[model samples]
Target: MKNYDKYTREYFTPPVSSLKWTQKEYITAPPTWCSVDLRDGNQALVVPMNLQEKLEYFQLLLQIGFKEIEVGFPAASETEFAFLRTLIEQDLIPEDVTIQVLTQSREHIIRKTFEALQGVNKAIVHLYNSTSVAQREQVFRKSKAEIIDIAISGAELVKTCAAQTDGNFQFQYSPESFTGTEVEFALEICNRVLDVWQPTAQNKVIINLPATVSLSMPHIYASQIEYMSEHLNYRDHVILSLHPHNDRGTGVADAELGMLAGGQRVEGTLFGNGERTGNVDVITLALNLFSHGVNPHLHLENIPEIMSEYERLTRMKVSKRHPYAGELVFTAFSGSHQDAIAKGMKWREEGNGPHWSVPYLLIDPKDIGREYEGDIIRINSQSGKGGIGYVLEQNFGIDLPGEMREAVGYRVKGVSDRLHKELIPDEIYEIFIEEYVNITAPLELINYCFTHRDDYEATVSVRMGEELKEFTGVGNGRLDAISNALRTNLGMDYTNLVYKEHALEIGSESQAVTYIGITASEGTVYWGCGIDNDVMTSSVKALFSVVNKLHHSTSTQRLVNNR
Candidate 1:
């Protein structure tokens, strides 16, 4: 007979081995990608999206193959209700998709929620309220009896309101902050809700006992969930779900432990974009299962499209450090990682990589729309011969001698350190030629001019190698003009060069540096750097610099005598 408080206290603090795992499951594999991005995500935002943006974002979520999406709290705002109504009126929802709205215990709000769902064919009214001691003490400041009363009233209202809808309607209730809630009390209240709704096995009600927050170690959460899993008498009549917040950066771990404890449902947003530290990064979590050979049923190949849509709708930037979908996640900057990935490539060519050289990769980058060739990043201080060699092999299918690779890699690193970024294949070739080929003359750009003004007309001309190369073009910027200059006079084709600039120094007076990553003929990537006080000039120069380097390197190489 464990005291409820004592049992919970113990559950919140447990041993590691009890939660450490070797296997994982992603329900999305069987196609159960639940999107809480708009709901949980909206609440987390300090400046929530406008109603139009919210509607657009909701539609975008469905486009990513999420059959069920948590839209927003209908009971909370008029704007939210309007967003829900917009979805209903437009009939924009897919037949297979279900829209979900959230609410609390107040009878008035629940009735309003019912009004909002009047014409919906399929929907979920997620009823939630805090149930744990932490909520009582810290948030609600209620006694146990008072909290239980709140729970019962809330559950009753949700049932009454949901009955108004004829189509597939679901009632999901969460013992909010359930991670720190006592089992008996939590169970008592949840069981009462079940008794009132009496949801059958086939039409089972969801009892979402979220970790709400990571209260302690993974094992403790596991134990608490396990205890609840074993204690439930009408298990077949309920869907036990878990929603874990990564407050301590272990939301993924806590959720995994809950699944280990028999939880069958998960709730999260893409890229873990939510309040505070965000929810468990669903991409990382799902792919984690994929790495271990569990089919999480999710089409991971759709990640880039999802990322692009998310970035557009949310107007939020995804950090490069973000896992899976981030620009840098699959890239390896360390020499050792590059060496291993390169060897893996060779073994792949030999048709034996799955067993041979696979240390750096847990999953193939190509499976997620990432180029395996880009894995060996030539960043400063950590790059080596392996990175340079791999880049040349990938871009040109030509191998450099090991000794030249070392020398070339060194020169590239020196420039990369000065430039502070990953050098591309053409940049590597330029640096290689500059170091190996004898260049008695350095062609300095004495003067350059590029102007983009008066409704997007642009032009550029530069004095280079004692000759004037002038080119005019119509584009959105001066960089485009300079690229035109290179294409017209330098015998360099105008490859699509992406100019992404960043300020290297702090404050308003800081100089902006432009890093141009160019994709040229034969799919080769070239990098160039430029610095200036003005953004457009820096970007233009960076674009031209790479072309200049490429032309000079090739010409200089041809002039050398092999004999």
Candidate 2:
């Protein structure tokens, strides 16, 4: 706080701009994505990736459908140069892919970069120079004219090297600190390089404007990109690209807005890994577009595999809360959130057509290889009846009645609260079975014979502990008559019996599951479940289980109140 006076806004604002990119609501299409993981991202690592690691990462980039990849700065290191040679000599570079290498505005490095590209089919000789005001004054000690001359000289040398090299080459130029440089100066230097390359309809040039260090809000950068796109030389022949770093945690925002401002390509890393905060996350950016019903043109169907490989090779961990890719991004733990998500999923299941409007979920988890039961409705102390019931119905095919769900929900929450952890689907099912399914305790139904006539009658044999007793009661329905037999034999009393049944298909064939709930005299409700191959037997077991639960709970509550 004491040094707050020393820092102020250091970013340069471009001349008054009438911005049009704001009118667009979203990115209409995918941009040409170039992964800089091998270069920009690798350099930022504490222990940079080795040759084999780089090779593995290169294959991953290809698998993700990156057309252009900045493999490395060959002139900077022997390993970088060797990686390029290995890819070229081993025929690893795909015919459709183009490898790009970086260099500064020097002659020998430029020559060495070309040497690394020898015998390659296609390559992009990326030439860049620090053109920021700070770099010109402090680092280079050069004037504006001198800086422009540096870029121009690099452009000419790249052109010469491409002609002499034994490989096909394209040209790319970057104002390294475009965000910190004056907008007009950035344009002027890029145009000077364009004038040298003379890009045509058949052969296009890339003009990359990097937010080497984020200096302002994203819209300001978008405006800068728009100004350059509108006034750049040979606009049709130039591919305006954006390389945003996440120093401000808005790299994705900058890339999206920049595309709207006429940029056609993005250069970033897998999970935004780079120097300070890292580069823009190409995965997040592409998937954001995918969520809006636009195909990102990249294969990100299996994100878990991608994240695993990325972390293994890079020694970096993707956060559990990262957008669209994190483990917990789609998971709901709050009771209300889980309830809504469960209801929304049910609505989708019951609907007649395809629509992805699930509440609290922007995209379907299944699209990215995530399971709905495990990943969506997670169970914890905060989970509710709807989510818990949904988990059972979806994974285990046991549907609880409305009031039974509430009772079971509280029981599950109590267990989770005492254990201080979240419960998995198996654990939840085990709790359900242990607590409510076919419980035979103070009372157990031994046998039942029913007679259906104008009025229903039944002779039921039940066990009260070690003793067996028979009771005959008559009622309008078979189940009601059975209830009447229990009351006549054991003096049982309850009301408002409710039940639900469904076929249990998971790990079972021809299995039926039934749930029952009953209200005792004190307005306390108890729930139970029974699973069997016969629906009638399952229903009888469910009724007996609920009766036992009610008797045990009432006795326990009475004992505790007396104490």
Candidate 3:
């Protein structure tokens, strides 16, 4: 903390004041997305991908709907050169997709880059040279004039190669490390390149402003983009692009605000895989629009398959907390969060609205190859009764009473806490059954005969410990009649019987589930559940369960007091 004085704001602000981009709420449309996973992302890996691996990743980018993908720097290595040749010779390049390759200002590398482009249908020859202040004095050891000459020479060479080459080609130039360059100087170099390419409506140029090393907050980057958007030559014929890296962990924010400042395209890798912190994540950017009710023009519905192929090909593990594509992004482990999510999902289900407005979730998990049963409301020591009850109703179709859910939640949480692990759906169901369903110990239901003469008279035979006892009572309903019979004949001091029933709607079994709650003499409530094919039988079993639960609680209290 004492070294704080060493860090200063090295970023330059745009010349224009009161930027208009700050007034925008959100991006109304998605930008043209270009994936550099095969180039920028591959080079950063501990081990570069092989030929077959590169091919597999290329196909994945195509499947993900990338119209422009930077395949690799063909002239940098033999494998990269060979990968381009394979794509061209094998006719693997789709007609609609245009592959881009990176190169520098040197002549031999430019020539060899064009050689790899032979027989290709369409491609972008991307030429770049660092123009930052540090690069000029330290890395490149060149003056401002020399840097401009490097970019202009590369621009002219790219034009000459496009004319001689056998394939269709376009031009793109990036002032690499543009964020570290003065705004006016960055514009000057880019305008000189535009002069050589002479981009038209049909043949547009892409001037990518890469945050090669992010140095400041996103607002500063947004201001830089706005300055470029306003002052750049051939503005109508140029597709302003942004390639933001996450050095400061604000790449996504930078891209969003940059787009609002008039950027028309994005260049990033999936899951933000690249140099340093990584490239801005295209998946996160695209789905952010999807969550805002705008189509991102990318097929991200099957995210699991995309993630699987990405990890397999790149050998880079996607973080479990990665936005939109992580394993646990939609999962809620906090009790309050789970409860709100549960209620929100139920509201959506009952209304069946067109828009997604779930409380904790920005978008529906089901829309992206995720499920609510296990993925959304996960049970743990921190889980609450609402979530536990939602799991039962949503997965197994057993809706527990409100008070009963509290009791069952505590029991489930106790088990999870002691074991120090999360409980799965089947395990939670098993716990529910073991703790509260059809529990008969001190009092067991033998049989019941109900005669509806005046109201409803019921004669029930029950086993109390080792004795078989018969009880008779009258009430309006069969459940009430059984409760009356138990209290009157067995001297059980309980009242205010409450119950609810519903038909099981999930899975293969056809049965009815009933919940019963009763208040004992000490004003303590006991709850139980019964599942059976017949509703009447399930109700009787439910009442018996509550009686046994009440007796067990009293006995436990008595033992504790004696101790």
Candidate 1 pairs with clashing backbones: 28-297, 29-296, 29-297, 29-298, 30-297
Pairs in steric clash, model 3? none
Model 2 lDDT tens row, 1-563: 79999977777766867389999988889999999999999999999999999999999999989999999999999999999999999999999999999999899999999999999999988999999988888999999999999999999999998998899888999999999899989988999899999999889999999999998899999999999999999999999999999999999999999999999999999999999999999999999999999999998998877886887788787786898877678888899999999999989899835768999999998897776556455677766677798888788877777777788888898898899888998999999999988888888878898898888898888888888888898889887888888867767778888878888888797999988888888788878788889888888888888888888877888899999
TM-score of each: 0.64, 0.68, 0.68
Looking at model 1, report the run of 10 residues with the lowest lDDT sum: 13-22
Model 3 C-alpha lDDT per residue in residues 436-518, reported as the tens digit of each score: 88887888888999999778899999887799989999999877788888888867898788889988888746788889999
Q: Which residue pairs collide in model 2, if any?
A: none
Off by over 4 Å in 1: 1-32, 165-167, 353-357, 375-563
RMSD of every prediction: 15.8, 13.7, 13.6
Model 3 TM-score relative to the real fold:
0.68
In model 3, which regions exceed 4 Å deviation?
A: 375-563
Question: Could you tell me how far off, in angstroms, the CA of residue 83 lies in candidate 3 after the best superposition?
Answer: 0.6
Model 1: per-residue Cα lDDT over 350-436, one tens digit each: 887354336677777777777755653443434546667677656544344444455556677789878867677777766654543
Scanning candidate 3 in windows of ten residues, the lowest lDDT window is 371-380
Better by TM-score, candidate 3 or 1: 3
